[model samples]
Target: MNPARFLLPLSLLAAVACSSDASKKDPVAEARFENEKRIGDENITEKQERDATFVVDVASDGQLEVELGRLAQQQSTTPAVKDFGQRMATQHAEISQALGVLAEQKGIVLPAGLGAEQQKTRQELAALTGAAFDKKYLELMVDDHANDVDAFDDMSEDAYDGDIRGFAAKYLPRLKEHLELAKQVQDQVEAAK
Candidate 1:
């Protein structure tokens, strides 16, 4: 290529670059910038943000519950505990999936596994078997469900997102039912031991 031919195009390109308005914003960049600037819009208030955190914590617990319940369903000698485990595993897996989708839609980030306390609880359970496992698992179930029922009941009424509120509302009674089942199984395990 001729040196003059290359030099002419380079000069023209530089001239064109210098001619455009530097202040003119790119549409995609503008939208992205606006989105970042508008982080947590009016629809997502501090209360809603707190609710989102609640949703994520619940999701994390849900995943742990499902995993633990799956183990129980496999290992429990007690038929009632096994049945309860199966129910918890099935119901909680579904809830986790729903919460995952909702969190994505709402631009909330949820951790993939159990939180520290739940992880510790899971580790403790993993070290046990037979009656010990049955008793501990049932006890945990009762405690977890009692807490979950209250949390869901409160969220059902107070959550800013209608879907989240409806979700909590739909599941509050289910959690209560699970709590009742857990209590019954705890009684059985206690009597047997």
Candidate 2:
């Protein structure tokens, strides 16, 4: 055989070998390598970011709502305030339990307590008494429930996982109900103030 023919066959064999090696790469390792290269370019996976944010935020809000509801139950003079507070405590406790179970199933870690802003709000509510406590508490509820409704609505529509999306959808209507009631209660408190 001519020298050129011999070289061409060798080159073809090398190309095939290289391609097979590339095909043999571990998919998981390759993905990690690609992800590592993206570190400085906002490269954290969306699933990771979403899960982290959801767990922390949901835990913090649940803790804050439960604590505030208990405070309302303890300190309010008005029957309506007391009832609302008790209802909040009861409902949010259930929500927290459900969230905890879901987070556990998803292997997500959650914070033990409220975030800074929520803690500050809780501390402020703790310091108030009588009509001041009732007014501030109702106002906070209206605001908080408004935020909750928005967050839950977004999750219901946008979550990538079916379980999470379903959870958000199931609770969104209840959140809306709480917001409407909170608004009415807030208006009532304002009128009396």
Candidate 3:
């Protein structure tokens, strides 16, 4: 029974396992990367390119919002938070579907899931529960909706495509409402602490 021989093999095996795990491909991420690259490569006008990028970015956000909302519903004990979560899940899902249709019409390939940063946010939120989850989730919703409102506002006013502009205008009011609701819920969550 040679101790060095056993230890060496075990360490080598562990290293190999870790390397394999690290190298494993996430198909959704690969598809998203390829779609982005293809968008850049396509022979299109700058405005069209910008529109495509907007669609992809919004699609990713919508997917992340839907997932986070579902996570909140599952983890939060508070009724208001849970209700907000359900609203997010439902509304974002609808938004994603509409964006998908628009992307297809524009010959753009949107990502199938969350972007890297969004995935990180989802992972962080998934690790929290109860009051911590409620606070953090509300904070995220407030921040996200605020940013969304700004982006949508700009697009609604400045988009090169009429359809895109219309879509942005259509959603801006709802996003603003979501932001206000998020702020109210956040205050409630904080006051209860």
How well is each residue in 1-193 modelled by candidate 3, as lDDT tens digits?
A: 9999999999999999999899787889999999988887673567777877788888988998899999999999999999999999999999989988888888889997787899899999999999989988998999889989999999999887999999999999999999999999898888888
Ranking by TM-score: 2, 3, 1
- Could you tell me how far off, in angstroms, the CA of residue 46 lies in candidate 3 after the best superposition? 2.2
* Candidate 1: tens digits of C-alpha lDDT, residues 26-142: 889999988876775744677787788888878988988898898898778888888888999999988888888888988889997777888898888888887889988988898
Q: Select the stronger candidate by TM-score from 1 and 2.
A: 2
Name the regions of candidate 2 deviating beyond 4 angstroms.
Answer: 1-44
> Using Cα atoms with residue i matched to residue i, what is each candidate's TM-score against the true structure?
0.74, 0.77, 0.76
List per-prediction Cα lDDT, in the order shown: 0.86, 0.85, 0.90
Best by TM-score: 2
User: Comparing 2 and 3 by lDDT, which wins?
Assistant: 3
Lowest lDDT 10-residue stretch of candidate 1:
36-45
lDDT tens readout by residue for model 2, 57-148: 87788889899999998889878888888998999899889988888888778887787898899889999988999999998888888888
Name model 3 segments beyond 4 Å from true. 1-44
